[model samples]
Target: MTRLPTPAPEGDPRDGGRRLMLVEALAGRWGWSPRADGDLGKTVWAECAL
Candidate 1:
């Protein structure tokens, strides 16, 4: 059986920022619709598939 790496915990500061940066980078790369706040909010409310 193959096992996947576990996702980062929600409360870790470094992991939290890293995930947000990745999301913003992907969004910029693909030209997706921007968030209503004009930026990726500190807390992501949804999971977007790249």
Candidate 2:
């Protein structure tokens, strides 16, 4: 199973950049690829198929 860092709100410029960097690091280091992602009111999530 792949693990993703808890997401940061995209509304903040700094957090948005940090979120992208985390994703990139996971992709580069572990070959993790996101299959889908979205916001659900109070919650947000991204999934990757193994």
Candidate 3:
């Protein structure tokens, strides 16, 4: 089983910044595109088969 570290408080003096950096990087990697970026609009629909 994988164990994730407990979330740190927003103002932890020692590790908060480090934790934020990790989270931000992961979010960018997996998150959806911002509405204003690229060619995507408010909705996108597609169909395909793998």
Candidate 4:
């Protein structure tokens, strides 16, 4: 599993939304699986399978 770091611009709602959109795009393009760990909202990670 590979980790893709998606750091959203702090204190910006639009950038956060864009980050979410990016995650969705990646998931659609490469079929990445997103799983939330116990710590939510602090990190966004997409697992890549080769």
Candidate 5:
């Protein structure tokens, strides 16, 4: 059997606006909590409610 590796996501714009857009989309659609800024001192989390 053989498997193929996933393709990398398209590159974001150098200004990083596109990267943040992608993150927000995924978090919103998946019910995932966005990452915290280090100053928040919170644990990483993922959650969804059925």
Candidate 6:
């Protein structure tokens, strides 16, 4: 029988960095909604949620 490679553990700093980069790329390409008070983190989170 064939076996698949084991997946890497989650929440590693490297993984976090990769996730952040992915989020940034998505935000840049699609653009985020405007925030009521110009909160960047909130905007990023809102975009990421979508």
Candidate number achieving the greatest lDDT relative to the actual structure = 4
lDDT, residue 48, candidate 1: 54
lDDT of 6 by residue, 5-43 (tens): 222446555432345455556663433334668663323
lDDT of candidate 2 over 1-50, digit per residue (tens)? 75644446656665333455565545533333454464321222344445
- How many pairs of residues in model 3 come into backbone collision? 0
Greater lDDT among 1 and 5 belongs to: 1
Candidate 2 ranges with C-alpha deviation above 4 Å: 1-15, 28-50
TM-score of 2: 0.25
Error of 2 at 23 (Å): 0.5
Model 3 worst lDDT run, 10 consecutive residues: 40-49
Instruction: Give the C-alpha lDDT of model 1.
Output: 0.45
Which residue pairs in candidate 5 collide?
none
Candidate 1 residue-wise lDDT at 37: 81
Cα RMSD to the true fold for all candidates: 12.4, 10.3, 13.6, 8.9, 14.3, 14.0
Summarize candidate 4's per-residue lDDT along 1-50 as a digit string, tens digits.
66654546667675354566566666634332345664434444565445
Q: Any idea what lDDT model 3 has?
A: 0.41
> What is model 3's C-alpha RMSD?
13.6
Winner by TM-score between candidate 5 and candidate 4:
4
* RMSD from true fold, candidate 4: 8.9
Record all residue pairs in model 1 with backbone atoms less than 3 Å apart, i.e. clashing.
Answer: none
Q: Candidate 6: lDDT over CA atoms? A: 0.43
Give per-residue CA lDDT, model 3, range 1-50, as digits (tens): 52333446667776433454455445533222235655533222233333
- The CA lDDT at 39 in model 1 is 77
